[model samples]
Target: MPEVFTAYVRIVDGFNRRVGRIVMYGIFVLMGILLYSSMSKTMFLPAHWTLEMAQFVMAGYYLLGGAYSLQLDSHVRMDLLYGRWSPKTKAVVDVVTILMLFVYLFFLLYGGVSSTAYALQYSETSYSSWSPYMAPVKIVMVIGIALMFLQATSILIKDIAVAIGRPLP
Candidate 1:
């Protein structure tokens, strides 16, 4: 069972890393597009799609990178007290906190899927001057929530092993 959990963690972590790198590049592209749009507005023609497109890229960046950030333990955490705990104590704390994380992710996944479905069903748009379809980003959000939830599970397994003095694979 420990080996199986380890394999699962490896796969989830790998997926997060892959998605995170892609999103990192996507953010860079969004930056470049925004920059070009800014310069063009002062010099020649303003690109209307630049803002909308950048938003799309940013949404992807945020959604796809969430699991990766969690995997790296990079989320905002109050470390003053937590940093001083022993490994087993930290694992116990993690297991307790993860329940709340799981609950939040559960709601996000539920809401995101409903929103994405509605958007796709009605061909929803932003109603902005440079409006774009909303379904794609909503779908990405759902995917990201699922990824984060999976990563949380993976971490929980490791924490359990640590707390129990089991050698993690």
Candidate 2:
């Protein structure tokens, strides 16, 4: 509808797309970690970090890619009534219902930021034997959640545009 909103959508969409593309390769990293874990278990003593590292990578992969998934409309939905709706109807529905998503994302982001702050302040570590520092992953979580929030806002703007018959490119 406005140049500012159009710019925001473009920038957020482009950045998230790049991030998602890069993060997609994380699956290979996870596989490599698992492969090494298996080999080490058979050939030598199992490493303490492999399991936990894999978990971290998986979390980063999904959480970081969340905005991209939303942009692509790849996130799961009920689709019961949505699939039958006309484009303009869908945009109107999305404009209204997206408020709930914003609320949810706001709470999630708040909690993530608070937890990340605590982790950074206390130099928190996992309870696992390896006990890796928790701040890095917590920071990643906060960043990912923030990106999702931005993407959700962009979606709302686009939906508004569509509802008003000024659909963005």
What TM-score goes with each of the models? Answer: 0.94, 0.98
Score candidate 2 by TM-score against the native: 0.98
lDDT values, one for every candidate = 0.87, 0.94
Q: Which candidate achieves the best TM-score against the true structure?
A: 2
Measured with C-alpha atoms, the lDDT of residue 52 in candidate 2 is: 99
lDDT of 2 by residue, 11-107 (tens): 9999999999999999999999999999999999999999999999999999999999999999988999999999999999998888999999999
C-alpha lDDT of residue 8 in model 2 = 99
Query: What is the C-alpha lDDT profile of model 1 across 41-138, one tens digit per residue?
Result: 99998878888888887877878888888988999998999999999999999999998999999998999999999999999999888788899888
**Runs of candidate 1 exceeding 4 Å displacement:** none
Give the clashing pairs for model 2. none
lDDT measured at residue 93 in model 1 versus the true structure, 0 to 100: 97
